[model samples]
Structure formats: structure tokens, C-alpha cells
Target: MNPGSEVVVTLRRATAPDARPAADVWLRSFAAALPTVVSPRSADEVRDYFRDVVVPLREIWVADAGDDGGGVVGLMVINGDELSQLYLEPDWRGRGLGDRFVELAKERSPVGLELWTFQVNKPAHRFYERHGFVAVEFTDGSGNEEREPDVRYVWEPKP
Candidate 1:
């Protein structure tokens, strides 16, 4: 697809078969977005986590591009009021897919939502801020698996 062109995708609840491809999107997105942070788990471990835990238990959604034969281009996981995970294919960035994922997250949890992103990810900060989230907390890498300093953002529906 050409840059800045509108790409179509269907967002739907992930099925058992979507686990691996969703994990691949997550892996690729993570690598591209946070090249400096070291991940605690290996690629195989991430895939296993998606298959065994995320797909089975979480409110996970995948942006499927199968209509155009692009497979799964992005994935989002919402856990309660937390937008636990949101990742898109590197090539799919700037195409508004992330905005769509955040919109779905808000629709799923209209009361509010919270998420954490590493401090180094400026693009993520801007993205979430644009979607109405405010940075509410900052920590010095004490409480996360990656031990990377991070910021917490929260969004509550307008009164």
C-alpha cells in the first residue's frame, strides 16, 4: 500500500487461530517502537503467552486485514479499565489504526481507561494525549518487568 493511503481492516475479537499472528504484530511493533528497551521474554515466550493467556482470557482484539490478504496488522488487549496492550505493524503506523484501537478501548470501557508506556516512547505519549489521556504518573523503573522508566496515562469520559 502507498504511504498515507487509507488502508482497510476489520477489528474483531481474537479467536484461537489469531494468536500467533497477533503475537507477531506485537513483537514487530515492540521492536520497531522501542528499540532501546530490552524485553524480558523471548519471541517464543511471547507467542506462548498470547496463545495460552491473552487469547483465552483477555478482551483481545485484532485488526484483521485478511480481506486484502494482509493478515493481522494490529492487536489490542483491554483488561478491565486498562488498555493493557496496543500494537500495530510498523508499516501500519501513521495510518490511524492506533486511533481506532483507542476508540474501541474507550467504547468498551466508557467510564475510563488507564495505560502505561515507557518514558522513551514519545510517539505513544503524543498518541495517547491526542486521544484524551493525561499523564498521571511517572516512575523510575521500579515496578515493571522491563525495568524501564515509564509513565501512566488515564482517560475518563467527559462529565
Candidate 2:
């Protein structure tokens, strides 16, 4: 379904216990969103990362495309002031879920916000740019030596 024209996504606040399952979805959605191949994390590490990092900052949203068969199509992981992850299944991209998700996140974040996009993810870079996020910095080798550089974007919320 189209993001702006045809999807009815449901959103909810998640708890600490949700981090593992959510991160599981996050990793899968990440592979779906990007070309990178990644293995799933051990169950325990998933739980720990969620508890220590994902859950505490507390501005997260999970979405499902109306039908249960759609499974969880999206996951957004946010920190106190910045968005850490906003991933969706490929089928669900371009419908504007990413933009709406960030808006929801900005409502909860008390400070100006920022996000990092890999240089290779040109479509995503365009999506962020279209939504009024401006590139503030660039990093070398996509946060590592194997990939392209990372582009950082900043968003100053409207009053």
C-alpha cells in the first residue's frame, strides 16, 4: 500500500521487554531496508541492548500494516534527542511512514533532533531531505571501512 495514499498503520509505545523482539524486527527490517547482510544477535544480547539502550530513552514506535499477516512492518528506535533507527520493510517504503514516524518521535524528544544515514542509501537520504532534515556532517566509510560514508542530518522542530 502507498504510505500517503493507502496505508492505515497502527502505532504503540513499547516497554523494556519489547526491546529484544523489536530489535529482532529492527535487524530484519534493517537488512530489508539496506543492502547490508547481517546476522541476528544472540537472544541475550538482544535483551541487554534493548534494556540498556533502546528502552531507557523511551521514544519508540512500532507499526503494523492493518492485517496480522503483514506482521510488524516497521520499528523506530529513538534516544532522548535523536532518532537511532527508523526502518521498514521494503514493500512499505515511500508511503511516508518514515516521515510520519519521525514527526511522532519529534513530539516526544525535548531537544532539536538528528539522524544518520549512510551515503549509499540515496533514496533514504532523499526522503530525509524532502522532510526538511538538513545534512550537518559526513563521516568516513559508512561508520566502518567496508562501506560508504555516513551523512548526519539535523531537524529543528517547529514551534
> Candidate 1 versus the native: TM-score?
0.95
- The ten-residue window of minimal lDDT in model 2 covers 34-43
Off by more than 4 A, model 2 = 1-7, 36-48, 66-69, 141-148
Question: Candidate 1 — which residues are off by over 4 angstroms?
Answer: 1-7
Q: Which 10 successive residues of model 1 have the least lDDT summed?
A: 1-10
What is the C-alpha lDDT profile of model 2 across 8-27, one tens digit per residue? 67777776655665776766
Cand. 1 Cα-lDDT: 0.95
For each candidate in the order shown, give its overall lDDT on alpha carbons: 0.95, 0.72
RMSD of each: 2.1, 4.4
- What are the per-residue Cα lDDT tens digits for candidate 1 across 31-54? 999999999999999999999999
